[model samples]
Target: MDLHYSPFDFAIQKDPYPVYKRMREEAPVYRNEEDDFYALSRHADVVAALKDSERYSSKNGLRLEPAFWGPQAEQIFSFVALDPPRHTRLRALVQSAFTNKRVQALEPRIREIGKAHLEPLLSGDTFDLMHFAGGFPTDVISELVGVPEADRAKVRDLGMAIMYREPDGGPVKDLPPSAMAAVGALVGYYTELTIDRAKVRQDDLLSGLLDAAEGEDRLTPEEVVSILILLVGAGIETTMLLLGNAWHAAAAHPDQKALALGGRIEDWVEETLRYDPPSQTIARTTVADVEVHGTVIPAESRILLMTGAANHDPAVFENPDAFVLGRDTAGSLAFGYGRHHCLGAILGRLEARIALEALTAHIADYEIDEANAVRIGSSNNRGFASLPTSFTAR
Candidate 1:
């Protein structure tokens, strides 16, 4: 069999671990001529590239699609696409608002929101877990961003539209017109929200972002809108997918699922992240000619740091395929590494933990209707779009 890998390939996207394993052993520095990108599948190489931002630059956003890659990438990805200095400054200012205190304080509210959403879905018969998975995080983020209750559904729909694509397409090379429209709509909506918040300051993240100052500097209106837009995908979509993946994985492994349901929510979150993460591939551009495993990847070349492949490398994880709870996942790149590490990670985990805790409090067990489960088609993300699940209530 010939060695071939492309993130755009639907078959590969559906279950990439097999191909990732092959790439790790056969070609650590794998190249796909069809997509015009190089991929690093080995754990060591992916981690090294993630850490050495100087060589593996993130200036071209995190995905290789034509619409997302380039100097203007930050408009969509915000500070995530920027290299140091600029990244450092903006992150600092944003952090002043997205403080630990702010996130930690949301636990009570997260529980409240969790109960509000989870209670209705526990009607006994099969219900799509995605209904809960998708709505919970959006409401949480909307609450944080000061979005009115009426507007949250619209926000979630827009976010879902942006993250969705047909999993059986030719090649998801770029965002379709519908997704582009969703982006424009979200931007316009946030622009109005930010402007309104500016007029009347509220105790929300948006207001905090507007006032987040380093010395005399503060985030401008445009910057705040960009950050909010970034949150629609980062803060909401990622967490939403993580919850769905956790639920689906637990259903697949009953023993591990029992442990998770038996007050090991933290372990559940951590293992799910390592075993099958939402973020599968993150792309970067080579700043200089880089030689890895005898292959010289030229400067300015697009490269993908295959985090999904790295997580399953036996060299790093013992019995990497098993869904083991409480295993050591020390060097996992599930949330990325170094400069580009996900800022919303803490909030993401917190939301998952609380949401699951709420679920376990009510349900004894749940079963996923895998035959009808629909996986969201994305180049970098991997998770369910519609997971019809039946629950056994406690």
Candidate 2:
């Protein structure tokens, strides 16, 4: 049997685990000449690649799609797409805005937002979990960024517009016209929002970013807008998907679901991250030739650190395929490593934990209508856009 893989293929995206298992066993350094990239499937290799930013650089952005890869990626990905010095400086400025005190401050508000969205759907009939999964995070992020209540829906719609892809339209090698338009609209919207906040100032993350400084250096207007856009992608979208993945994974395993709903929600979140991470693959560009498992990838080549595969690698995880809670998920790369590690990770986890806690408080048990569920099509993420569920109220 031949080994063939392409992240852009929708079929592969739907169920890449089987293929990932094969890649780990047969070709640890799997190559897809057609798509022009190499992949690392083992846990150690992916971790190594993520840590070795000098050789496996993030300068070209963390995605392989044509529109998102290259010098312009920074406009969308912010510090996530940059390497040291520049990455270090921008990350520090962004970090100041997300201080421990500030994130702890958002917990009460996050719980309120989660309950507001989840309470209305507790009637015990069939409802789509994605509604709460998507809306809760959107509202949380919008509130944190100080987007007015009136404009949050518009902002969420714009953020979601860029995530859709044609599942059967072959591999999406470039962003579609709709997605490109949405990107432009988001940039324009945030740019204006920054200008507005600059004048009137507010008690929000956007305001914090504006005030964040390193000695005498501070973020410029364009830089502030860039970080806001990054939040939409990193903070809201990924967190939304992570929650949905957790809901779906729990339903798939009744035993684990019982434990999760029985006050083990934190373990549920951790295991779900290790089992079915939302952000599956992270792309990087090679600055120098690298050899792994007897294969040499030349400099200037595109490479994918198969985060999803690494999480399931038998070497790192015991009984890697099972969806069991309470496992030590300390090494999971659901969030990457090194300097480019996801800045929104702490917030993402908090949102999921609170959202699920709210959910289990109202629902006694739930079952998924998997036949009608729809997974989002994207090269870098793996999660549902719609998860129809039936539950029993507590």
Candidate 1: residue pairs that collide: none
Deviation in Å, model 1, residue 65 alpha carbon? 1.4
Task: Kindly list the per-residue Cα lDDT of model 1 for residues 1-394, writing each as its tens digit.
Answer: 9988888787888888889999999999998887899999989999899989899898999998888999888999998888888889999999889988999998899999989998888776667888888889989999988999999889989988888668656777899999999999999999999889999999999999999998898888988998999998898888888999999889999999999989999999999999999999999999999999999999999999999999999999999989999999987889998877888889999999998899899878889888899888888999988998888888
Cα deviation of 372 in candidate 1 (Å)? 0.7
Error of 1 at 76 (Å): 0.7
lDDT of all predictions, in order shown?
0.90, 0.89
TM-score, each model? 0.98, 0.98
What does candidate 1 score on TM?
0.98
